[model samples]
Target: MLTDAQLLAAAARFGTPLYVYDAAELDAALARVRTAFTDTRLFYAMKANPNLTLLARMRAAGVGFECVSAGELARAVKVGAGGSDILVNGPAKSDEEYAEGARLGATFIVDRAEEVGLLPPRSRVLVRVNPALEVSTHDHLATGAGGSKFGVPLGGVPAVLNALRAAGHDGRGLHVHIGSAIRDATDFAAAFARLSELRPAVGELEVLDVGGGWSLDADLDGIADQARRAAQVFGAQLWAEPGRYLVAGAGVLLSQVVGLKATAHEFVLLDAGMTELIRPMLYGAVHPVLPLWPRSEAALHNTGTYDLAGPACESGDVLAREVPLPRPQRGDVLALLEAGAYGAAMSSNYLTRPRPAEVLWDGEWRVIRQRESVETIWAAET
Candidate 1:
């Protein structure tokens, strides 16, 4: 939990539309998960928030990493993660990524039959099985459900395994990820039960990669119970790649109100837009937006609903719709809560807006990522 003063100070020093991450909060989230899943091997999905500072902290906490690309693998290595401590998972891995994974001795979560052929001889691999389990989440985030491009279908797992064996790769495990932002433990349990039914075909599983999709407010105890059950049924080591669960609440995006519009519906415009934080616009996701400074009694009592919007040209750049807030004045800062997950990771520079700076606050504040300059943004152009 960041204080309003702290947020204001950060915004003042680093400039508006900045990202602030609480290191203590991140460690606490990790602790909570560890306490719940005592025996499960936890892997931090780097895609959630890949700031090097955060990665270094995760490494210090003894958590392994789940890398989805060559760039992520390099980040893991840069953060001092051992080759064996990394797990490579992605549907569109390049030839270079496979060779790099082989070089790093990382476990590969094979999403397709061809992926197995790409692995090094006798390399450790886990077949990602798409069980087509429907999870209570956004349709676009659903991965294990039918028609998803994430994993090999359950019926296709055997063939993938055979191909792995033929390629001299060690096919020793199974992986399943229903979707992102999963809110129910039963969904995970059901997927695990389905995996149990396929045990006969998978054979002697050594690892069960129960992939990550946990919501920010998901029930950890229930998830732990079901994960334990899955471990028992499969007789294998339990593994989870938690991305959002470990980091979502540890961050906040700080934006300052630039202007106000007296439209049919009141609009509070901010300097931050889709380029700085895209979740709200991209997935229609809702993030709690609160004024940094306390409002007056009269302002709070006489509040009206306003559409909180950004500076982007797109009409979809609205962050919150018809949300009741005390009247916001220009230059007032707002904090977008629960933004530690996909917030910064999925940000883009659309409209040529430079990305914002990122600060890590443990006991003190330090800039982790500096605000991008226009020159830096255009440095690659010929």
Candidate 2:
């Protein structure tokens, strides 16, 4: 947990529009997961936050990694994760990625039958099964339901398994990722029960990868209980790939209030925008926003509804709407909570604005990533 002083100091030291991650919070998250899902293989889904420092910390904590690309796999290895400790998963994998995964001995979570042919013979693999069951979550985050572009449909699982067997790949397990930000335990239990039903069709499974999507607000005990049930029913090793659940609440994005706009609705314009944190614009997501420091009790209590707008030119660049906060003046710093996952990882050079710096604070603050400069942004331009 970062204090106002630490956040304020980070803003002062690194300038506004900075990402601050607390390593202690990350460790605590891992501890919570381990405590809840004891003995279950925990893989840190690198897509959520691929900061090298964070990867290193996770690796050191004896956590495996789930990578979606060769680059992510390489990052996992660079951070000290063994080849056997990584699982490669994605809807579309290139020949190069297959080659890399094969060379590194990383398990492949085959989403399509064609991907099975791309892997090395007798390679370790998990067939991603789309149970067509929808979890209670944002539609965009749902992956296992029918009409989804992600995993193999339920009806097609047997064919895909036969394809893997024919290809001589060791189809060790079944993987189900219904959706992300899943808060319901019944969803997990249902997904597992559904996958367990396929046991006869697949025959003698060795692993049940109840894929990542657990939300920070989800019932950990309920999820673990369901996972235990799945493991017992399938008589296989249980595994999970947790991304946002492990990191979303461990970070904060700091931005300085640049000015107040008097529009049809009052707006508090901040230096940070979609370029720094785009979840709000991307998913209509709401992140708790609060002033880092208040002048007095009155300043804290003098609240008004305002639209937290970003510096981005697009009208959709607003961070939050109808936000009730103390009257903010110019230079007031604001903190966006639950920004650890996908904050910096999903940021881009949109509008030619450089991505903000990222700092990791365990005990001492260290700049894990320097703020991108204009030259860095255009360095690849021919």
Candidate 3:
């Protein structure tokens, strides 16, 4: 994590409405996962925060890339990732994505029944198993829920694997991603135990990817122990695709207070809103706030609560609700914590709001991604 002085220096130099990431924190997060799961291969889920520079860093650290689209694959390639270093995943894939995956020799995560025919010849594959177990998290975040359109159901796994082998592809093993932000460790224990039941069905395997959804405060070693048991049952290597867990705590969205409103409810409107960080609105995520601007020692005693609001027409643009603060004023700066993952990747130019710039802190501030210009957003449009 960056110090308050460092965050303020970044805001002063780069202006408000910017993202600041700590290089040391990123390395530490990766180390924590590696230290916990010593024998497993780690793949940083690109959808979380796919900054090219960050991708290059992960690549340099010997981490593979898990991409869901052609663009993400290209980002991996740009960072010098080889074909075998990428995993092409997602249920609804395009022909172009297939072509790109094949051209790169990437492994395909077989999702549904029909994908068997669409895969490239002799491609290595892992059939995704939807555990269909109810885990503790938002419904939208539960990719393995009973009706979620992510992976094939447990029963359908055999058919997909059989079809994959029949199509002359390398049926390496099985994959199960219960969901993201998982709260219950038992959820994983159940999924892994259930997968062990497939021993007679899947037989001995090469890779057992128990997909990552372990919460930030999760018992990683315990979860890893459960995963090891499942992989040992098949005598396979374990793989994890951690998205939010790796980068969420290492980044922050630095925005300034534009004005304060006191109506039906109080709001501290800022330039960064749903356009910059939507996890709050999309997933009911609550991000911690840190005040950066100097507050007088006298007035510091008078603290108040405010809902951090963004500059959007929709009322849902509120980034956080009922946040305690020191009565922020115009031009005051604040940092939205735990925004490294999914914050930038999910940001849109909705209502023509140009995205904020991103900076990385590695003893000094470096701009990884520059702020988007208004013209560029509409330049591609007719």
User: How does each model score on TM-score?
Assistant: 0.97, 0.97, 0.98
Q: Candidate 3, TM-score vs. the true structure?
A: 0.98
Model 3 scores what on Cα lDDT?
A: 0.91
* Residue ranges of candidate 3 with Cα displaced over 4 Å: 295-297
Candidate 3, residues 249-328: lDDT per residue as tens digits? Answer: 99999999999999989889998999999999998988899998777886688788889999999888999998888888
The alpha-carbon lDDT assigned to residue 134 of candidate 1 equals: 83
Worst 10 residues of 2 by lDDT: 113-122
Better of 1 and 3 by lDDT: 3
Which residue pairs does candidate 2 place in steric collision? none
Error of 1 at 289 (Å): 1.3
* lDDT leader: 3
- Per-residue C-alpha lDDT of model 2 across residues 79-195, encoded as one tens digit per residue: 888677999999989888888888888889989877766787778899898888878887888887788888887778888888887888887878888888877878888888887
The per-prediction CA RMSD against the true structure, in angstroms, equals 1.2, 1.3, 1.1
| Stretches > 4 Å off in candidate 2 | none
- Over the full model, what C-alpha lDDT does candidate 2 score relative to the true structure? 0.87
117-205 in candidate 1: lDDT tens per residue?
56777799989988888888888888988888988888888888888887888887899889888877788888888888877786767
What TM-score should be assigned to candidate 1? 0.97
